[model samples]
Target: MTANVNIAIKHTSLLISGALLGLLHAGLANASGYPVTVQSCDRQVTFDHAPKAAVSNDVNLTEMMLALGLQDHMAGFTGVSGWKTLDPTLRNGIGELKELSPKYPSKEVLLGADADFYFAGWNYGMRVGGGVTPDTLAPLGIKVYELTESCIHIMDKPKVSMDDLYIDLLNLGRIFDKEEQAQSLVKGYQEDLTNFQANLTPLKTIPKVFVYDSGEEQPFTSGRYGMPTALIEAAGGKNIVDDVQKSWTQIGWEAVIDRAPEFIIIVNYGDVTAEQKINFLRSNPAFKNIPAVKNNHFVILEYIEATPGPRNINAIKRLAEAFRTAL
Candidate 1:
């Protein structure tokens, strides 16, 4: 009976030891700061820690990181086309970085760089191109963050708003443990927006505005949901293309003439210059007769500032101020 009692106590102790081990593992897993899984657009991404060595595939992501004061963490960058109107400092900094391939880096290159995490404006850079799928990177202990705005199918036609831009800044702040800096920047932006709106002369009427992005084959126009609409509303004008539901849409020149916008914003992308756009419009038989062209009310905005990101608010303010002066 004494021997049986000893065995029983030993078994009990063994069970307790196993339980303790399990609990210890759970604690460690919880303490490791494993990223909270969130569904973005079409996929699930796990951001394990504050990204130390980062790469930005989109111009807006780079702008957001710069705004958050996390520029030092950038490893390499792509998407330089958006910086046309940016401050010289930013444009020069990007010019100095190695041109990142449109696709993800190779496994050998990725491993050599030893990047802690990757941030991209869109997921296509990760999933389709190169062998940099999430599974491949995960085994090497790399994390990726895709911008919420880029996650289109997940949300019901996400409308790009200044509020979304501010939230993105806050999210980056939380990820990088720079909450205070992010808050300060966001607060300042809010103040700027509020002041701009309040001091503005009440518009007796909002002007009809047309935003033209890239187009030779198909003209890209902003729809009700994205940076274009936000820009139009913020600029104290109406987006003639607001009825279109997509972020970008293609329409006939007849439609533009039918609406007869009072002001036109021409967006220049990559090597394209504003002068080229003006020339194109002037030379084109269809666009030359528009009231905006006749009145010389066309303004040039770089493609970067026209996208959804931190710089968007500034773009809106500048455009609004310009329109106020023009009126």
Candidate 2:
């Protein structure tokens, strides 16, 4: 070949190589920033990439993933009852995903799915002694993103609020490179809260609220730290059990009678329906003369909203409207 032609070819090859090298460096920088590490529960969780195969335990976390448009990334799921209670649009998308179990899957089942990430909370998915935990799974290449509300006991944040939902969504967005979507969703929630609070101007009195989770012998209720406490306060209702200083606790009927709450918030989930709880309250003579029972004032919320998720804002809106009307 002519010397001039050889020199031209060499110059072209060098330019192409330089361009490719620059692209590779940029990609590496992005990768390094990713699989981002955050302290979850008591340990550090690293997301190497947005999980391609993910599993969500329980309906609350499942709906959270769905709301983020991350269902396509779900490899499998469990906790079927919550799925049944989801909105029609959300329910329609579940036909394709694999259901690992009706309840918490065994450790072997979780391993078999080879999920890159597991969206679950302690007790809600895998119990502590079951041998499957974030620490145990980390070595096997599966990391866990725990539901934030479930972490109050383990983390520095000991209270629950809409902030829990905001942080969880934002973290998921960062993991998936969808920060814009996360921020947009949070903004919408903030706007809804602001608008709802503005409409509460006419509420002259704050109702005393009794949150009913379950139990015939003892009434389970939202204590100082659960989402219900935050929701009740936001709705202009003072929680009668706010002094308990725990998430959900069982209180005596006499204590409830003494409180004489004007409103009762019944949680809808598990084997017992909200109607059953209301029935129990009405049938029991101990509750017969309670102001809430006498007035038929009860706000029924799905257990899903009782936890932290996108539906929490809806819970706030519903309670606010009910309180406004009742006032």
Candidate 3:
């Protein structure tokens, strides 16, 4: 097997083990209570009781909540990324909530909503400039749970894996007292993953792939670790810049030419069309001669799906299909 496939197999195995361990621990935890304190994102948040009203600051949290069938408990949402495509019912609900603005309702609005709990996908939304701090919300009897994968600077280090997605689902299930529903959802995801894996053919070779995301002045590319690496492997391609440790890194034009990737996935963000992306690459003197450009083997995916979350599975499938067709 190629190195990328080996890496993917090893990574998937480790994630499975870690997920099993996590599920075991979660199973043993005391479940009988009005509320529980779960440590996430380097913070200990005690949910004194099952929250009746809640607000989400990130789309992942919203997705998780809706998946857990806890939408009825959601009071509002703020700072959601515009890239995500939500379920029709959830989108309509958000529209109604926006019209209401029932309480604290700004990108900076975190208080005055009188929500019993606050769940954020990224802690950056609650940091200094984020309009609401945990301390400020705590005084009003509101608690916050920040998604562990998005936590950047934590000493103890939360383990992140593809399984963390399922763990997040289960955790939300616990919070909403929908354990059965959560299990069912996790099972469905596992089945989806299994089906995808079964469809995988033993790779004869790992195709070279380049991930071009937003960056007009300086291009952003996936590094060795994190979501992009996972996505690349899943798509049956190898990231040209996989030696770097960071999730993403800036690389010069010369390095990209040297790699000479066979396929390029241009991550579409904010008002950028696929044709515009192709034009941008063709206009770049440095990239004009690359095989990807010459062969027109470029694909565009939404920025939100490219990030880590439930949408990542969709991104992987789309990417795999795109590469398969191009190859």
Candidate 4:
């Protein structure tokens, strides 16, 4: 080969090696500070990298993932349409990703999707010893992150608060590498809540509110540890059943009537419509003495709003407005 050609070949090789080294350095820089650990319920889960294919259970949890702009990371979601119909906003936010299961998915479902992570909670998707759980899925190479609010099911937790929802968002952000987005959204929610609270008229008497979830023989209601209790207190009202000491539970009409709630929040979901639930309450002679039923003071909150999710802010706003007008 000519000397000139040999020199050109060596120069080209050197340039190619330099380019490869530069790309390697860039990759390392990007990968720095990975392998982060975050708290999930009672467990400490560590993520070596962001999940490529994750599956969130239920409408609220799924919305949490979507809020962080992590839709592309999801394989699909489950445990929504089986019970409550999706609101337009939730539908649009999820885009074209399909529901893997209309209800709680089986173990095979997650495996079929090749999901690397599962976002679920106790009774949200998996029961305490159900077929699908963190222990069950861990063997199959799927990491599970339990919802912060639902942690009360298995572990001792503080009284339910808006912070429960915020904690989930922050943990999800850490897991999915969307910390900035999560922090911004949480700050906005906090600010909006603060601003709304600031304009409130200090009530000499805070209205007593009761949440009617669903039940025929026994009325299902929210208690001290339920999300509704926190929402109610935030909206300048007290959940009449806050003394119940459980999250969601069924109680006798006598307890409800004894409390004499001034306002009732109907949870809209399942086969039984919110109107039917209210109608039953209004027509029942036994409950006629209750302040809420007597005055026909009631407002409906979607299942999503009653649960822990982004809709909580709007739910609090709506409840505050309803409380003001109902009295």
Best candidate, TM-score: 4
lDDT head-to-head 3 vs 4, winner: 4
**lDDT by residue for model 4 (1-327), tens:** 233333332332222233223323333343445776777889989899999999999999999898889989999999998997987888999998889999999999999999999999988999998999999999999999998778888999877877788778777777877766776787788778777776665455678899999997999888989999888877777889888878888999888888899999999999999999999998889999999989989989999999999999899889888887776
Instruction: TM-score each candidate.
Output: 0.77, 0.84, 0.81, 0.89
Query: TM-score-based ranking, best first?
Result: 4, 2, 3, 1
Q: What is the lDDT of every predicted structure here?
A: 0.64, 0.73, 0.65, 0.83
Prediction RMSDs, each to the true structure: 16.9, 16.1, 3.7, 17.0
Q: Report residue 43 deviation for candidate 1 (angstroms).
A: 5.7
Q: Of models 2 and 4, which has the larger TM-score? A: 4
Worst 10 residues of 1 by lDDT: 8-17
lDDT of 3 at 268: 66
The full ranking of all candidates by lDDT, starting with the best, is: 4, 2, 3, 1
lDDT of 2 by residue, 1-327 (tens): 233333322332222233223323333345446756554566666666788888998877887788788877888888765434544655776768878877787667777887888888865686665676787787888888887667755555555555666667766776666666766776677777766565454455657888998889887888877878777766656788888867777889899999999899998877788899898889888888899999999999988888777788789778877877775
Clashes of each: 0, 2, 0, 0
Better of 1 and 2 by lDDT: 2
